[model samples]
Target: MGRTKRKRLKKYEQNSINLCYEEHLVSLQKWMSNKGWKNHKKLSLKLFPETGRGISSKITVGANEVLLSIPMNIMITYTTVKLDIPVKNIFTIHESLALFLIKEKEKGINSYWRDYINSLPEKLPPLTWLANEEEIESFPSDIKLNVEYTTTNFKNFLNKIRDFIPNNSTLADSLLKWAYVMVNTRAVYVDPHIICEESSLNLLKDEPSMALCPFLDMFNHNYLSNTEVSIINEGRCLFYELRTLSSCKKYEQIFISYGNHDNVKLLTEYGFFLPDNCYDNIKFTLDEVLKILKFNLDNNKYKFIKEHDLHNNLYIGYDGVSYNLKAVLFIGWCGVINRLDSIIFSSNYPSLFLEKKLPDLIKGLLVIKKNEFTNDLRQIMSGRIVTESAQMVLEFVKFRIDFISEVILEYR
Candidate 1:
């Protein structure tokens, strides 16, 4: 039965790919033209190996060439929502956009944005989709906590806004949540107030400045991508292109940097993570460290540390553990050894904290984090195909553990 489910999933994926080739790309171009999109002749959407669908060039795209120039009138923004959707009061811009998307999605082919809407996944593969509570809990505490928080927030938001929708409106919690995430992940920041007040969305007095750009959102994220998106024509228009695409060969995929985001940020917000991410950091909280300590800290010591902001300095980056983390641990150790004189501990502690005992304490903390990560990886690998979202998270954990293990070896 499990094998059959896997086979079915594989077949669906192949069909989805085929559908993109045979229908989505062609229809998308036609729809965009009908909607008055300009400056997209040189680009074409194509599915590449490993990476999913992204815009590619048939001919060589020169540096500084504007690959896409979308007019302000066509963008899905606060103005579009205020005019089209009948929802009386939107608490936030995201909820407003999510409501609009849900209404349009229910319209099927009748909706003007049908082609683009259909191109989107029926549902995202966010960690919120994990069916088993245990599977969700198996993730690192940070990740698990984030997923729960976001899920709870979505549910609360949906409940708050659903009453405004008419009884005749079709509002599914799942679809509404998916639409919310779509807007959250794909929307780009743009100061709509810069547009002429005549064309601006004045009704939404408190709405955030963001817009959903078709075709542009399709580009996958690359931390090192040279592409830059900028506003032009008094912020009434937006354009993006590769800054150094002169070296790119024909049919090569063009990418854009989402932002200088870490793995945790990416996975939580975008449903993906980068392996060996240069920005990756393994964090340690003071609470966890306190729990792991063999000796109980006295009230005076705890109060002093808390008042002095001496907690939660631990973090492991690409360059191994941070020095601030070592200092905090050393201070705690000194307290444990009854050598923590308030005046002496405060003055020039960097050299003082580098004692022989410090490395052992740091090593022990690293080993504990490493073991936790190793146990999580074993459970993930032993399960059925974890999919890219889960796999990326697992790989990120493994990468951190490996880095920590190497740091421990350095202490040898």
Candidate 2:
């Protein structure tokens, strides 16, 4: 009985794949005709033999090219409620509705819009699969309703695009507007997975432009990978590449940038600290040093390491860590004397300063005992507190506020 059931499930899955493939091909042909492409057979030959069984295709208009792919086999599982009926029933309803709309559009029958909106009540079954009547009641009724509404909304959008194309607008412009509409309306979600080629053209211009490829449109890939291709007389245009098997929802952080190099530079510049060779044993008049530190602290400029002729290449040790102590002290002492809000410390080893040494230094400064402070500071340099380093850094920042305030008052 188990083997029989497995065989039946395998057949059902294959049938679903075939249905999706047929529907995709039909939609692609209709989209091509709508765009006024005359050589269907020739173009079909160029685009035929898709890279895989999935909904994927490449499109070229004049010199512009784009690759599109969709992951139709993706499963969305809802965990809060379980129904006695199989989940595939719900999937069938959604898939059937999508395929029906595509068919209606190809037949050029506008009335299907009204029919689709009105037919939702009869098409969707009740939540009889739920374990209890109360569970069914708690299920979101609006979600089921919105699914139908979204179908009608999509029909209206396609109609608008069809109208816009006949008005002599450029295909690229029309496709761009349509992509933005699809995204903003949330009718389809684009997967965030992206793979950018290093040699790609720079398409980030002041105004937006995008070319549509029907195969790419199907997948809803969120991170639109733009590939640069050079064409005669037209210069360079960005093309969308084929989608990968990876899933975007798994990653916690998403970074989108117009270009790779520019984004990296932005990250590094913001995190960089001034080098240590800028300060040495330069005698400052006690009054002068105090004033400089105070001004630097007030402006949060303690992290700015400026090179001075008097202290060229000289470095000093602080908290048993080798740093330009003169530069660090200048910044820290200024902040200490001025009672500044939010002192910014930039260091090449910011993680080290925060985690290992800064906490003990602050604690020692507050108590004004050199020997106790030196003993605690030694533990950091010797690597005994390596495991708790990050935690210590966070705590040190929290503890420094009181010490800073006290030092300012004492100096005043």
Q: Which residue pairs show backbone clashes in model 1? A: none
Error of 2 at 205 (Å): 13
Clashing pairs in 2: 68-215, 68-216, 69-216, 70-219, 83-129, 84-129, 190-222, 191-222, 293-334, 354-393
Query: Candidate 2, residue 63: CA error in Å?
Result: 22
Q: Estimate each model's TM-score.
A: 0.75, 0.24
Clashes of each: 0, 10
lDDT of each residue in 310-411, candidate 1, tens digit only: 675577665656655655565566645454544335544555456577667767777888888888788766665444556666666776676667567766
Measured by TM-score, how close is model 2 to the native structure?
0.24
Q: What is candidate 2's lDDT per residue for 67-125, written digit by digit as tens?
A: 22222211111110112112232222222223333333334545323322221122211
Candidate 1's displacement at residue 204, Å, is 6.5
TM-score of 1: 0.75
The lDDT, on a scale of 0 to 1, for candidate 1 is 0.65
Q: Model 1, which residues run further than 4 Å from truth?
A: 1-21, 34-36, 39-41, 61-65, 84-90, 126-130, 195-207, 234-247, 293-313, 323-327, 333-361, 378-400, 406-412
